[model samples]
Target: MTLRRLHSLQQWLKEKDVAYAFIQGKANLFYLTGFRCEPHERLVSLLVFQDNEPCLIAPNMETSLICQSGWNYPIIGYSDSEDPWRLISTHLSSLEIVGSNLAVEKELLSVARAEQIKALSPELALLNCEDTIMKLRLIKNDKEIAILKEAAKLADFGVEVGVHALNTGRTEMEILAMIEYELKRKGIREMSFGTLVLSGEQSANPHGKPKMKSIEKGELVLFDLGVVLEGYCSDITRTVAFGNISTEQEKIYETVLTAQEATLSLCRKGTVLGDLDRKARSIITDAGYGAYFPHRIGHGLGVEVHELPSLNENNQDQLQVGMTFTIEPGIYVPKVGGVRIEDDVLITEDGYECLTHYPKELLVVKP
Candidate 1:
């Protein structure tokens, strides 16, 4: 799979007349090389050439792990005492790749790193390859979809754990810990992002942090989280009432659910990506909760929790088959709490498939 992806990227480089591609993003590295690593402050990159075989650069300690990941290409491992950029320059010179146009992910490469790369050869023109890379990753293959389905199942399990752990006096952090602990027990080493267990007014903050505040009755508890499985990701958000919620809370939940469903109904091939968001926003606006519905309707979900094809009112991109993303419609009213319904969706040739199977109906958990 990685070799096939590399071949596609190399073809793009040749078509664009670029000689080399310096891929530095961890996700991009894993997508093209099958080796996933969090190098932190250390440098880890994949250099793909239009003609020559690609090579991977990483910290010396992780070289074995990279090979174990099925990467048979040449690898350059740097020690702490060595300057990686200098080594990279020497390696490029050895490969006779100096003074050639190199494509790099401008969004991921820092100014310092770019300068170091430029210093390697004054004649090298740095071109941005982010768009090409994104286009390549936008569509999911059958294998990727299968892995995503499994990841979504784990996300459903996570929500189940959160709902079961909910109690009147339990702190948000406590419930969050329980969810992560259970996932760890299931062999999940990392979450796509931080697990959010916001309750009551805290949920109104959208991206609020889980605090020590105890979840109380008559308030909504929101679980916004995803697990990283096999280098892919799954994101899901489901809000439930602690006990008997007020009439207004019920209205909010139902409205959000309705909006989400309406948006998801349009997830088919040839549908405008932005139209989905506009449909949900229109419903929310007509229901007089437009102002409360901040943020985009959803985001593309795959190697990263947030990737491409952002679901907003202005983007005019059309939906395509094998595309996986989230359709989350939320309404957040301060002091009154918030309600968000999120589901991972896949655009099919005929229609769409909702990868997440967790119940979306409002569940009033008895305190």
Candidate 2:
């Protein structure tokens, strides 16, 4: 039931003098409630109160499923032609929430939705609760860690599939298709993020989409992919060579590898989160590829691929036990190619554990 999470949230609401909270983010809703779904144009939400039973407001179509999901709370369902806010207003008034401060996820709630909620109660003061929710979701429980470990294994298998499907003349799209097809055959329902397969000069674009261009020998191929397994997510990136590679390519690959490994070594509890990015940046800058490494070192990974505690400069948060995130450092050179080595890691009491055990050493696919 995620009761611990609810307790923490209720405590936060009490501290802020908020009557209740509207958790609108789909991912956050699933984290607190066991059920998950997307209601496109319909209103699906979880209204949590500081001192009362939480309510799950969903479409009428999902009412039976919500009841069967073992949610022993109030389930408020509305028809397509009805106004959800009206029912919500009834519930809020019953709880004496009118003219009180209510917390909402400002980062996710749309402006139109906020206006609707304001219309529901003219005197309601809406406060942003994204920071409070981020704190609640920062630490991973034992079950979450276990699910993430399994997801990481699937991610490694995905890389292996992509590496085996590589050929001298295969298009990037072809390889991407083969990788996804094989993973689906093994029960991977979805990828955490878009599957990126870039070859040769195309790899220079860190977030480039796969193209139909044929892969050639003696060039670098970057595979950045992840998978969703058991509601958890895994993300990884590995750059490999086709046939024979040049010394410059080897240098770039090695430099990124060194930077990634060095930063990973400092991923222990109590270490400043931003220092990891600075440490990796130092290595890349020393190798004269600082500008090429554009993005941050990595981000937190869990129910959603990207979560709290981003590993980048300017964030002063310290790593804590049970926190999981990625460590990806890349070197992208225009007209040449890019090299990115990423691994999911978990912070422990003593040190950090690397979850994704895919080989980071340069892999060469034969023609």
All candidates: TM-score:
0.98, 0.97
Tell me which residue pairs clash in candidate 2.
Answer: none
lDDT tens readout by residue for model 2, 74-132:
99999988888989988777775522687889878788998887686666689998888
Best by TM-score: 1
* Candidate 1 segments exceeding 4 Å error: 98-100
Model 2 TM-score relative to the real fold: 0.97
What's the lDDT for candidate 1?
0.92
Q: Candidate 2: how many backbone clashes? A: 0
Model 1 per-residue lDDT tens digits across residues 248-356: 9999999999999888888899999889989999999999999999989999999999998898889899999999999999999999999999999999988999999
Error of 2 at 62 (Å): 2.0
* Reference-based TM-score, model 1: 0.98
